[model samples]
Target chain A: TLAAPAIAQSAPELKWRLTSSFPKSLDTIFGAAEVFAKNVAEASDGKFQIQVFPAGEIVPGLQAADKVTDGTLEMAHTASYYYWGKDPTFAFATAVPFGLNSRQQNAWMYEGGGIDLMNEFYAAYNIHALPGGNTGAQMGGWFRKEIKTAADLKGVKMRIGGFGGKVIAKLGVVPQQIAGGDIYPALEKGTIDAAEWVGPYDDQKLGFNKVAPYYYYPGWWEGGPMLHFFINKAKWEGLPKNYQAIITGAAALANTDMQARYDHLNPGALKKLVADGAKLRPFSAEILEACFNAAKETYAEMNATNAAFKKVHDAVMAYRADAYLWQQVSEATFDNFMMAQQRKKAL
Target chain B: TLAAPAIAQSAPELKWRLTSSFPKSLDTIFGAAEVFAKNVAEASDGKFQIQVFPAGEIVPGLQAADKVTDGTLEMAHTASYYYWGKDPTFAFATAVPFGLNSRQQNAWMYEGGGIDLMNEFYAAYNIHALPGGNTGAQMGGWFRKEIKTAADLKGVKMRIGGFGGKVIAKLGVVPQQIAGGDIYPALEKGTIDAAEWVGPYDDQKLGFNKVAPYYYYPGWWEGGPMLHFFINKAKWEGLPKNYQAIITGAAALANTDMQARYDHLNPGALKKLVADGAKLRPFSAEILEACFNAAKETYAEMNATNAAFKKVHDAVMAYRADAYLWQQVSEATFDNFMMAQQRKKAL
Candidate 1:
C-alpha cells in the first residue's frame, strides 16, 4: 500500500548520486544504475534525481564497495567477491566454485532469508544491499592452451574471483582477482595466462577473443554471479516508501533484463568466437576431479574457521544440495540425453 | 566446429507428440513444458519418446490459422479467448465482469482455459485446449476513472474478454482483447470498473495495490485473464514426443505452481488488499464514454470487416501495433519498481 499518498501540491525534491563498478559497455550490469536513476526520476516525476557514474570514473571496480562502505559516495555497484581479499566470508555474498546457478541464488537470497542474514553481515559496514542483477552460470575462463591434465594447471595464472581462486590456488596456480575492464590487459600482458569472466557476450565485448584464443566452458568458480546495488544504509532507510519500492523494482528489472540480454546475445557471440579461430575446449575429468576435491577441502576449512562463513555456507550448501538433486532428476537427465544424442565432430 | 560427420544415430528419435505454445517453463511463454517431460523418460533412458504440440497445439489458439490440426492430442492447455462464445472472443478465455481471481479461476480451470475457450470452441469440432495458466492482472479494470469529468468513460467497456458478458451489458461497455493472467479479473468484476491485462506482474497477481485504490490503472479491457496452450491441426501432426513436455513444465510450475498453489502463501496478501479494500468500485460515466469511443471506434468498425479480423476476430485481435515497445519502456519501468519494493505482498 505504498501507493502515492495524498501529498501537498508541492513537496520538496530529493537528489542522490550513485556509482557503479561496471562500464557502460556492459549494458546489463551498468544499465542497472541507469535504470535506478531513471525510475527514481519517473516515480517522483523528475522531482527525485540521481546521477550515475561508471567504474573508474570514481574508483577502481573492486574498490566500489569500500567506497560505498566508507560513504565516499552514497551508493555503488559491486560484486561481493572483490571484497573477499578483505574477508574470505565475502565469497558467499557473490558466489563460490561449483555453487548454485542463478535461480537457486535468487531463492536463497530472497525467499530463503539469505538476504536478512546477508544484511545482518553487511550492517557491519553501514550499507544496505538490494539484489541487483545476476549473470547466470558463467563459462570457464579463456585459456591460452587446452588443459590436458592437472599439470597444465600448475603455475597457470588465472583471474578468477572469490574462493574459487583460493581452491585453485591450492593446486599451485596463481589466482588473481582482476576487474572486468582490466582482465583483457592482464591476460594480454601475460600477467595472467588465463581468465574467466561471464558468458560469451560479455567476453566478446571485452574482446578477450583476441587475447585468449582457447575459450573454455563452465566457469566452475561462478555458476551464477550476482551483482549488488550498495546503497548507503542511512540513505536507504530515509527514503519515502514509494521511492524504496521504485528502487527495488528497478533492481529486479535489471536482474531479469540482464539475463535475457545475455541469453539472446551469447549464442551468436559464441558462434562468432569459434569462427574467429578461438579454440573451444572442455576441462578434462581428471582436472575437474582434483579441483572439486580442493573446493570441498577449502569450503570445509573456511567453515571450520569462520563462524559467519559457516552459517551462510551451510545454508547455501544445503539449498544447493537440494537444488542439485532436484535438477539432476528433472533437468539434467534430459539435458545429458540430448547431449549424448549429438556426437562430437571427429578431430 | 563440433558438427559431426553424420555417423547415423538410431535413425533419429523419430515421431513424437510435444504439446506447447512455448519452450520449457522457467521462461519463454509456457517454457516449463519443455523442461518437464525431457527429464522424466531420459532418466529412464529414452525408452519413452515424445512429439511436441505447440500453440494451435496441432492447430492455433486463435482459430483461423490452425483449424483442427494435430491428430494425436485428444487435448491441450490454452486460454478461452481463442474461441470466445464460439463468437464473443471474451467467453472462450475466462472472466470478462472481471471474473474470478487467478487462483479462484485456476481452481475453475485446473479444475480446466475455465471451461468456456473449451466447450464453446471445441464443441465446434474435433480438438480442445486446456487451461495452462492465470496471470492475475485485473485492475479496477483501467477506468478512464480518476474520472472527475463526465466525459471520463462515456462508453468504455474495454477490450474485456470473458467477464465482459456480465458488466459491459449494463454499462454500455464494449470490451476488447488483451491477455495477462494476473490483473484482468477485478476489472471485469467491475473494480476501476474497466481494465486491461498483460502488463506488469500479470496485474492479477500484483493485486492492483499501490497506484489504484481506485483500481483504475490498466484495465484497458483486461481483468487479469488466463492463457491456454492450443492443440490441433490434423491430430497434432500425428503424435510421438512421449506423453509430456507440452503440458508439464510451467503448467506444473506456472499454471498450477504459479498463482494457484502460491497465492495463499504470498506475503502481505490481505493487509495490502483491505487497507485499501482497494476501494472496489465500477467504471463511471463519462470516463467509460471516452474509452468506449477509443475502444469501440478502434474495434467496433473493424469487427465489421477487416480481412485479418474477418479471418481471426473470433479468436485473436490484429496484433496491437505497439504492444512490445510500450511493454519495454514506461510499462516495464513502473511495474518493476513496484515489484522489488513490495516485499512479496498478496494481490
Candidate 2:
C-alpha cells in the first residue's frame, strides 16, 4: 500500500466555538455564520469542526467581541458598529452615517486598503476581523405618519440602532435603543412613534408593516451595513496556514451569499407588504439633506477627539468620492434605464 | 504513537489543468483563474493542485469550454457567452442584451434558481458551471467620431463580441469580429469605426484613447457579464466531497474579488484616460432606445425558434422586473444622492 502523504498525516482534529450576535430567527443575517461553519467543516473533511451559538446562548449579542478578544471564544460573528460605544472607530468596519454602499464597501474593503487599515486598528484589541456579510441599503423605517420635512422629525420617538441614533438625535428626535424582540410591541403599543429594522424581508417577519402603515426607504444611517467575523489573534496565529486560507475563503463566500440572499428575497417581501396596505414613501430631500448635515456634524466631533476614527474616516471619505463618480457614469445610468422600463411594464 | 486517521489516509494526490480564455496581460480577468487556483491549493494543503494556462497555451481562447466538455482539460475559466454560436442558451450564463446588473446576476445565480437552470442546460453537454468572475457594467466603446443618433450607426463598421453583434446588426451597423490584438490597428486606420473591449482599466491597457478620441458610457449589451469555471462533469463528480466544497468556495471568492477589483481600479483609470485626452460621451436616449427595440426583436425571434433559449430568457426577464423595482427604491436613490455630492466635491 502507498504511504500516506506527510501533509495528510499532519492534519489534526480540532473544534471551535462561535457566538453570533443575531438569533437564528433572522436567517439572512444569522445564517451567514452557519454558511461559514458549514464551508469550514466540509473543506476540512470534519477534521476541523466549528459549533455555532446564537445570541444570548453563550454571551449577550453586544458582548460578543469582548468574548472573542479575551479568548473566551474562538470567533464571533457580529456587526462592528455594535461595539461603537467602546470605541467610535469600530463604526467604520461596518458603516457610518452616509457611508459607502454595498458595492463600494466591498471595493473599499477588498482593494482600497480598507482591510489593512481596519485590521491594524483591530490588532490593538487582540482581535482580527474579516467581512462576513452586508445588508445592502436598508429601508428607513416603518412609521405611523409620513415625514414630509426635516421639521416633522422633531420630538418623534423612534427605535434606532448603533451610531445612527447619535446623528439623528442632533435633529431633535428621541432615539430609543431597543432590542430586536422588543421593537414590535414598543411600536404597536405607542411607546415609540417609529422603528427601524433591516430591509423588507427581515422587517416583514417582525410584522412592522401590520401596525405602522407608512413604510419609508433609503435608510441613510445604515447604507450598506457590513457584519464581521472577529477572531482572537492568539488563536488565529496558531492555526495552520491551510486552515487560515480556508477560513478567509469561507468568509468571502459568506459575505457574498448574504447580500445575494437579501436581494433575492426583499423584492417579494416588499410587494407583499404593499399589497397588504403598507404605504411606501421616500424620505423627502429636505429631510435627507438635514440628516446628511447632521451626520457631518457628528463625524466632525468624533474626528476632533478620536485619532483612530479620523484615520479611517479620512480613508473612507476619499474612496467614497471616487467610487460614486465612476458609478454614476455606468452603473447608475444602466440601472436608471432598466428601472424606467420596469415602471412601464415593458420588461 | 497515535495512528493516522482513516480519512487522512484516504486523501489522494491529484493534479488538474485549467485553461483560461483570457491572456495574462489582462490581469484582472485572467487573475481570477489564478486566485481560484491559489485558494484550492492552499485549502487542500497542496494535495489537489490546479495548473492554469493562458489563452492559446493549450487551445485557442474561444475553445476553452469545448476542451473541458471533451475532457481534454479538467476545467476552464471563460465567459459562457463565448459559446453562443453552439447554443444561444449559453449566453444566459454570462449576460444578455439589457439583462441584470452585477448584484442582480449574483442574486439570480445564487438565490433565484439560475445555477440549477444553467446546470440543467449544461448537463446535456457534460459540463458543470460555477460563476467565476464579473466585470460589472462595461463602457460602450471607443469611437473615431461621436454617434449622436441612431442614424449615425448606419453602415458603421464596429468590432463587438458575441451575441451583441446579432442585436446591433438590426440597427444597420456592420459588425466585425476582430481579435483584441488587431483592434487598435483597425481603429487607427479607420478599418473599424468603433471598438469596445471592457471598462476603463482593461481598456486603458489597449491604448484605445490614442486612436479613438470618443469614449462612451454603458455597454448595454454586456451589463454584468459573468465568467464561469467550466468543469468536466465526470471529473467533477469523481472528486472527494471535501475537494468539491473547496472548489465551490474558491469560485465564489473569485467571483466577488473580480468586481471589487474593477470597482477599485476603474476610477483611477478613467481619470487617467480623461487627462490623456479621451473625450467621454453617452449613447443618446434615441440611440439606446433604438438598440433596445432591436434587441427585443432579436430575442423574440430566438424565443420563437429555440425552446432552451425561451425558457432561460423568460425566467431572467421575470426576475429582472422585480429586482429593478426594489433597487430603484433604495439603492438607486441613495447612489443618486452620493453622486450629486461628488459632483459638488462635498464628500
Candidate 3:
C-alpha cells in the first residue's frame, strides 16, 4: 500500500559545507568527499547542495573532526585515526594495526556491532559517523633498500601513521608522523629510511616509487582504512527523513565507489611503477613476525591503560576471531590457488 | 544553487510488485528483496511502495527475469546466472566458474566497466540490472562422501547450477539441475549423490547437514555470486530522479548488508553444524585443480563459438587478471598470515 505523495513543490533548497582531511592533490582520498557531494546534488535534483573544501581550506586536515564536533562545520570527511591522540579508541573507528581488511571492516561496521560501538564512543563528541570511503589494503610504504630481517629495522626512521608507528617503534625502528604532502621529501632527503602512504594508486601520484625503488607491500598498519563522514549531531537530526536517506545513499555509494576505483587503478599504477624499475618485494617473514608480536604488545599496553581503548579493542578482537576463521577457509584458500595458477601461466 | 523541489504534494502514490527467484524460507537470500522494498518506501516517505513475492507466488523462480522484462512484474530479485541457460553470457553478470571474489566483483561491476558492458547486453532484453546482493565466497557444497581426488568425480550424480554443471560435466560428473525446494529431499532419498546450495547459513536452514555428513568448502564455482535487481526498462526510466536515487541507495545498502549478514551468520551456523556431528572437509587439491582446468577449457570453447559470451568473458577475464594480482599482494597476504596466527593461538 502506498501513501499519498507528500513532497512540497516549493521546498526550500539546503546547502552545507563539507571539510575533508585530505588535500586536493591526493584526489582519491579527498576526492571521495566531492563524489559524495556530487551524488547528493544529482540525486536531490539540485535541491540539496554541499560544497567540499580540501584540508586547509577550512580547518587543517587533522582538525576536521574537531570542527564538525564543535559545529563550526556541518560535517567532515576524515580518517578517524587522525584523532587517535585524543583517545586510542579513535583508532578503532578508522583502523587498528593488523586489523580487518576492507570487506571484514565493512562487515564489522555494518553487522558485527562496530557501528553501534563506535557511535557510542563518538556520541561523547556530539557527532554521528558514516563510513564514507575505503582505500583497500595499502602497500607497506616505499623503501630505499630491501629489509631482510627485524634487525634491519634498528635505527631506521620510517614515516608511518600514528598507531602503527607506535607498534613498529618497539621493533627498534624510529617512527615519524609526517603530513601526506611532506612524506616524499622526507624519504628523498634520507630523513626517513622508509615511508608508507596508501596503496599503488596514491603512491604513484606522490612519486614515491621514483625516490624509493623497493616497493614493499601489505601495509600491516592500515589494512582497509576507512574514511568517515562525521556529521554534527544536531545538524543531522534536524534534517527531513528524506534528506537523511539521501545522505545515507550518497555515503554508501561513495564508500563502494572509492574502493572499486582503487582496485581498478592500482593494478595499472603498479605495473607502471614496475616498468620504471621499481622492485616489488614482500616483507620478509621474520620482519612480519617481529611486527606482529610488537603490535600485540602495543595493543596490550593500550588496553591496560585506556578503558575506552580496551572496550573497543575487546570487541574488535572477538569479531575478528570469527571473521578470520571464515575468511581463511573461504577467501584465502580460493585466492591462494588462483593467484598461483595465474602467475604460473603468465610466466 | 538548489532548484525548487518540483514534487507535488498530491502526486499519486506509485505501487509496484517485485518477484523473487528464492523461496521465503531462505530468509537471508530472499529477504534481501524485502529489505530493499522497505528501505525504498521509508526513504521516499512511503510514496513509493513495492510488494515482494517469493518464488512460485506469481511465477516460477527461474522465470523471474522474463516476468520483469515483459512487465508482468515491475521488478524481480534473482541471480543473473540463473538464466545462463538462455545465454551463457548471462553468467558473467552473476558468477562464473572461478570468478572474482565479492570485493573484486564489486570493483569490476562498479568501476571496471562491468556495469556498462553488462547493461549493453541486457538492453537487448529490455531489462535493467542492479547489483542487489552477494553471498560472499560460498562453501563447496554438501557431499554424501568425501572426494579425495579428481577420479572421485567420475559418474557422480550431483546437483549444480547451469554453467558450473557444464564445466564439471567434462570431468566425468553427471550434473543435475534440481529445484531449490526439492534439493533436500533429493539428497536425502539418494536421488542426488551431492548438492550445492549456498554456504553454512543457508545450508543449515535447508537441513542438508542432517543427510550429508561431509561438508566441503570454497565454492569455487560461485565465488561471490551476486544477486541482481531486474527492472523493466520503461518502469525504471519513468521514475522521478529522486526516487531513482532512493532506489540506488536502497539497492546498494541491501547489497552490502546481505553479504555482511551472511558473513556474520555463517560463522555461527558453521560452528553449530560441526558440533552436530557434521564433518568439515576441504576438496582435495587434485579435485580443485581438475575442476579449474575443466572450467578454463569450458570458457575457451564457449568463447570460440558464442560471440556475445566471448565479448563479456574476455572483459571479465582481463579484469580478473589485474584484480587477482593486486588482491594476492594485499588481501591474501594479510588474511593468510593473520589466520595462521589465530589458528596457532587457538591450538
**In order of the candidates, what TM-score does chain B achieve?**
0.45, 0.98, 0.95
- Better by DockQ, candidate 2 or 1: 2
- What 10-residue stretch in candidate 2 chain B is worst by lDDT? B1-10
Best by DockQ: 2
Per-residue lDDT of model 3, residues A60-152, tens digit only: 888898998899999999999999989989988788888888888888898889888898899999889999889988888888888888898
Best by lDDT: 2
Q: Which pairs clash in model 3?
A: A141-A196
B340 in model 3: Cα distance from truth in Å? Answer: 0.6
Candidate 2 C-alpha lDDT tens digits along B1-347: 25456455435778999999999999999999999999999888888899999999989999998899899999999999999999999999999999999999999999899999999999988899999999999999999999999999999899997888888889988989999999999999999999989999999999999999899878999889999999999999988888888898899989989999999999999999999999989888888889889999999999999999999999999999999989999888888888888898888
- The true-versus-predicted C-alpha distance at residue A192 of model 3, in Å, is 1.3
Order of models, best DockQ first? 2, 3, 1
Docking level of model 1: incorrect
Give a tens-digit lDDT track for model 1, residues B187-247.
5465435554333223335455444455443242443366654556334334332222222
TM-score of 3: 0.96
Q: Please, what are the lDDT tens digits per residue for candidate 2 over residues A29-102?
A: 89999999999998888877889999999899889999999999999999999889999999998988999999
